[model samples]
Target chain A: MTDLYLQDWRAWTPHRETAGECRLDTREKPAGAAVPSMLRRRLNLLGRAVCDMLATLDSGADSIVLHASRHGDGERTLEMLYGLNDGEPLSPARFGLSVHNATVGVYSIASGNRRSQQAVAASGGEWAALMAEARGYLADGQPSVIIVFSDQPVPRRFAAYAPESSSAAVVLRLGRDPNPGARRLSETSVELELETATLQPLDIIDWLMDRRRVVACPLSRRSWQFPAVRP
Target chain B: MTTTALEHELKEMIIETLELEDVTPDDIDRDEPLFVEGLGLDSIDALELGLALQKRYGITLESEAESSRQHFANLKSLAALVESRRQK
Candidate 1:
């Protein structure tokens, strides 16, 4: 089990009317105010949500960034596929921003952050991978690591092959040192094993907002426990 | 010398293709640079604009040709290129 301090967090969802302390205006898309107009134009809804959530958190310039997504920019990929099938030349902008790391790359560029950035797209257990990555960074003596998890529902073409999911994003700043105002987060392995399971962004948001003690993920056979908010 | 209908249309196309929300047809100076200085566009925008031109006008640029860079240098050059080369 590894214990880490949750220095700060912000979450967003298109379906939910409220996400903990952040109340998103459902009528309009997230403006991504922190990102400049030039770069912001490249982001889709999910990317914009991630940027908006990150803007609310104290993401330091030197902190390392770890971004995980189950379905990274499926719409853009689908568009390119259609163009290819029709023998139409692909849009260079779409092709350039189609990579899994493109969202975080845009964020890094907009924020002028030269720190280390890692993008993960695990088949499952992406949340666990993110937590493990954050823990590893903390153990390596990094002051703080910014962990972002964002995913959107697969495009219509891939809906049959994928499970149903809503668009959501969660950004957390994890640190080794505990702060009195921060929440305490720890990971524990559970004996119950499942064949395929992954913690969703909504799971983390629910755990953080509600008075829940344990959020379990059978996919990874691990559980994250929010022991208490430090006083 | 003046902004022609095609130039106006090209400006609108540039704004729409790049999603330059803050810019309009009137904002694009025909003789000014479209990249790296006046409009502050970068390589990605250049590629995007090239794709847009290809789709709309069947215009294809040789990536290594010096003339292609000159054609993309300003809106006036782009308009001139389109007037002489546009297929559609």
Candidate 2:
């Protein structure tokens, strides 16, 4: 769908906070209430994914969002279980933070865009669901939804049931067209291999980046070489 | 286990388990507080440490348990709990 003017893209990792960088007083997330370390790892990873999207996007996008971890805050779920056993003495803040929408909520809060569209997909084909929603939102042929795909590794608690890969988050700005010099959703990922098995998007990027070629490899899978984008 | 070894082991576990990044195993003092002064661990760290203890030692400390405070009070205290749990 990204037919024209979509070419520019950039990527980056946040500079590690130096001791001096840590001097900037960071506000407490979940405020005065503490979330588990794993949950905080999710929060931090969310920030990284969003930043990557913002930094690399063609800049033609007016609205954006992130889709992350199919598990959708498993650590929070774990905490909820813990809270129940701990006399049901749940922390209101932590409890509030456990909602599935909280991932997008944090982004909305950070960007000061109450109107920004964000969603989480518990599985691969959910992108089509978002695209379907976009069609309704953009019936006028105007761009609307910028879908992002980010996922974190599943926690050990659910390892047996809905096993997950390592921690990861991915952001994509889905729309009609990106910016000038931007690469359109060229070739329209004609036939995707949505593994009934979970796929980690970031892993795909890393593999492509490593091979400097878009190996047909699904992000999480290793054995199969689908097709490299180019040499 | 004697008190010194217990403290030594506690410090080792905290440093290794948390990936404290800024602190080394040797930096932690046995008598130093675990929550604030020494490692600056927050409640989440407590949960993580609890999980680690359970995984490694097969022992758990409930939040409401009276002995939990005494067990988690400091490195020395935690070591004592670990030693006793091991004995049992």
Candidate 3:
């Protein structure tokens, strides 16, 4: 079991209620003004959402960033695949941005953040893996870790493979000490029953907003539990 | 040198292919450098532009060739290259 404190969090989605400082506006794409136009132009919906959340999170410079996604920029990959099948060369920009770590790499470059950045992808328990990675960073004596989880609907061709396909990003700052307004996040191993994989970001947002208690994220055979936020 | 119709077309192609939302064909100076200076495009943009040129006009560039650099130097040079070597 791993115990960590959530220093702060911000989440974004196409459909969500405005919660405190975090506003949900689905009318327009996130400007991501922190990122220069050159790099911003390359961000897709998921990347923009992640950047948007990061902009408001105000993560410290020393904090490590971990980006977790179930299907990272699958649409870009699909486009490149189509071009290759048609005997046409892929767009170099699209080809470069198709990797799972591309968005976080762009974020790191845009923010001028030289801290360690990592990307992870798992079939069902990506959120747990992300938190575990953050825990590992904390164990390594890092003061804080920024975890960004972003996922979007896969291309239509691969939609059937994903149980839950939605666009959302959640950014959480984790630390060893519980600061003011911080929530306690506890990870415990539990027997996992057969359950459809839920969109972890939305679940996290719901938990942060006090709409839900205890985020039970099931990976393969084990589940990570986050106990209810203490008052 | 005057901006020819081909140069204008190439500018449009650059703006569209690069997704330069703030840039228009008229915003591109015919003689301005396209890399690291005038238009502020980088190596990735150059590669994307190369692929766009290949797809639209069936043009290709040899890797690391001094002549290729000259052809991609500016809008006028790119239009001239297309005029001479376009397969489609």
TM-score of each predicted structure versus truth: 0.93, 0.48, 0.92
CAPRI band for model 1: medium
Clash totals, every prediction: 0, 18, 0
lDDT of each: 0.81, 0.52, 0.78
Instruction: List pairs with backbone clashes in candidate 3.
Output: none
What is candidate 3's local distance difference test score? 0.78
Q: Compared with the true structure, what per-residue lDDT tens digits does model 3 show for residues B53-79?
A: 888888878868999899989988888
TM-score between model 3 and native: 0.92
> Who wins the TM-score comparison?
1
Per-prediction DockQ? 0.77, 0.04, 0.81
**Which regions of candidate 3 are displaced past 4 Å?**
A19-28, A58-60, A220-231, B1-3
Best by lDDT: 1
User: Chain A: TM-score in each candidate?
Assistant: 0.91, 0.60, 0.90
Q: What is the full ranking by lDDT, best candidate first?
A: 1, 3, 2
Candidate 3 per-residue lDDT over residues A121-166, each given as its tens digit? 8876788788778889888887778998888777898778767567
lDDT string for model 1 (A150-171, tens) is 8888898889988777788888
Candidate 3, residue A144: how far the Cα is off, in Å: 0.8
Better by TM-score, candidate 3 or 2: 3
Clashing pairs in 1: none
